[model samples]
Target: MWKFILRRIVVMIPQLFILSVLIFVLAKAMPGDALTGQLENNPKMDMQTLMEIKEKLGLNDPLYVQYTRWINHLLHGDLGLSYIHQQPVIDILAERIGNTVMLAVCILVLTYLIAIPLGVISGRWNHSWADKLIVGYSYTSFATPLFIFAVMMLFLFGFTLGWFPTGGSVDIQLEQGTAAYYINKMHHLILPSLSGALIGTVGLIQYLRSEIIETKMKDFVKTARAKGVPESRIYSRHILRSSFIPIAAFLGYEITGLIGGSIFLESIFSFPGIGQLFLQSIMQRDYSVVTVLVMISGVATLVGTLLSDIILSIVDPRIRIE
Candidate 1:
């Protein structure tokens, strides 16, 4: 397992390099840049001043030179400056990433807690009313768009009922570190977290239910039943255990989504997370911030995939990493 993890880490180096190149090229190729947007809005800005600003930003440099400089700084833990915010890219990300991580963790926990057992039960009781109800819920949840769900939730819970704040990570008026502040923070988290979790839960439930049903048909399960193993033990030790392999494998992708946060949901909820930050950076053409965020996401996805593979290997002795 350790060797496999090391190999995966080594493999990520080249993938990260390629990802950086693609992100940098695409960002540069975009029609408008931060400077161009600034110049457009400030048409009276003198050419001399514009040239100086471009030089300062290394905009006049060759593409390779700029990329080289950016990579060098990145290796030294400098994420460069956000043109829009005039702050270090890392700083901006730092402020937002915690919120995104918090939101993602909440969504992940809620999704698993709600989806897994329900899926198992639905599969075990196939054709029953409970199974039918779960199936209906899964389909409905999957069919509904995330943005629409978020809006409806906000309208119902925020506007009409006023049970929670409509948006933001916390109430600005609340004193930080106080009980009111933390309570308000959790209150703000509920809608956005539920929005993401509901969307995620549908797919998980569907997958796990299918896995459980399939695993129940395996020869091992039939053998266990023939041996008169306790029904609960057979289900838990054999069926559910085997069913988890596929779910564990898929968890990698889910982890990536959770870390990145849901862009539409975050935007609708006005949550200060990496998703909203990414959107704002794109609008402002803040390539430094955009590049860092993309790189982080890509790396996170790769790591998650690796972790999933390791977990699968651990859970299923039949599977081995080369």
Candidate 2:
């Protein structure tokens, strides 16, 4: 497994290089840099001054020259400076990525915790009342827009009932590192996390339910039933395990996506997370931040694919990677 992972890592080198090139080129291609936008807003700044500013920032360099410098900095753990924030891109990311990771991880665990057993029961029951209820839940969540659901949650739970904070990740007034501070942070996260999880669980439920129902029709399940296997044992020991292969693969990709957060969801909740930061940087034309974020997302996608392979092999003994 270690050797296999190492081999996969080696394969990813070229892919990463390609991804970096695309990300950098595309970001640079976006018309107008931060300096241009800033200078335009300040009408007094003459074209010559703008040119001088661009030159100082090396924005006037050739594409190849800029890319070579950017890639070299990237290879050495330097993500460059954020044009909008006037700070290192990594520094800004360090401040925001944790919030996104924490929220995303909570959403992921909650989504699966609620989705898996509910899916199993729904599939096992097939056409029963409980199955209908779970199906209804999945459908409702599917139909509801993420932002609409997030807004409804914020209004009902946060604004109306006053059960949770309306927005933001924590109460800034509270003393950091204190027990109360942590509790308050969790409290603030509840609505957003639950909102995201509720929306996310729909696909998982559908996937698991369909897989389970399909698996039950297989000859092995019928053979077990014919051999006098207990219904519980057949479903628990045989069917449930077999049905998880696709779901595991699905979850591997799902985990990587959490790092990006939902722009609508995070924006609605005023959550200080990577998604919101990405949107802000884009509006401000922060090339460094935008490119690095895309690079990170690209890396995550590659890692997610690798994880899917590993998970598929784990869930199904027949799968092997050389």
Candidate 3:
């Protein structure tokens, strides 16, 4: 098991290396550097001053030189400075990443809770009304863009019925550190979380549904049914357990999708998370922040993938034994 884990960890190294290189290269390929429009609209600044600032920031340097410096700083645990925020990229994100993670976690839990049961029931009773209804809902979710859903949810929940707050991670009007405050925070999460969960549920539901259908046809399940095992037991103990392999394998990808999708929802809801920061950074041409943010997301994906592998291995002893 240790050896398997070690091998997986080693594999991540090259993957991250390639991702970092690609992220840096693509970031540099953007239309202009952070200093492009710095003086264009500023009447007080002159061309020479702008040029000097560019020199200081190594904007005038060759691509190889800039990449070397950036990669070195990255290796040394420095994520570089954000031109827009006027702070270290890490520092700016430190204040905001937690909100994004919290939101992601909420959506993830909700997605699984709702998706798994629906998938199981639909797959268990293939061609039934419940299955058709779930399939239709899944198709609709796939068809609708996340941002549009977020806007609709915001308008309905935040305005029409006035059920939930539309924006912000928490309500400042409430006393901090109190039960009401935390509860209010969760309340603020409901609209966005629900929208994200609905969209995120599609893939999991389809995947698990297929797995369940396939598991039902397996020899063990056939034997269980042949012996007149209890229906609930055969469904849960036999079918569900066998179907978990696919769902378990999907864990890492599920999270990566959530964080990536958060960018759209965060903007629509005006949530102060990394997704919002990432958009702002790109508009401002703050490639430093963009590069770092992409790398962070890449890291999350790589680590999550590793976790999923470890989980599957632990759960199915055959993987470790092999």
Model 3 vs. true fold: TM: 0.94
Q: Superposing all C-alpha atoms, what RMSD in Å does each candidate have to the true structure?
A: 1.5, 1.5, 1.7
Q: Model 2 off-target regions past 4 Å?
A: none
- Which candidate gets the maximum lDDT versus the true structure? 2
Q: Poorest 10 consecutive residues of model 3 by lDDT?
A: 313-322
For model 1, what is the alpha-carbon lDDT of residue 298?
85
TM-score, cand. 1 vs. native: 0.95
Candidate 2, 69-141: lDDT as tens digits: 9999988999999767789988898998888888988899999999999999999999999999999999999
* lDDT agreement with native, every candidate: 0.87, 0.89, 0.87
Displacement of residue 79 (Cα, Å) in model 2 is: 1.0
| lDDT of each residue in 1-322, candidate 1, tens digit only | 7888899899899999999999899888987777776777797977788889999878999999999999999999999998788899888888988888888888988889889988998989888999999999999998998889889989999899998888899988899989999888998998888878888898889888998888889899999999999999998898888887888787778888776547787888999998998888898887778888888888898889887898789878999897
Candidate 3 lDDT over 18-130, as tens digits, reads 99889988987778767766776578888899899989988789988988899899899999987767899889989999889999999999999999999988899989999
Backbone clash pairs for candidate 2 read none
- State the displacement of the C-alpha of residue 318, model 2, in Å, after optimal TM-score superposition: 2.4
Global lDDT of model 3: 0.87
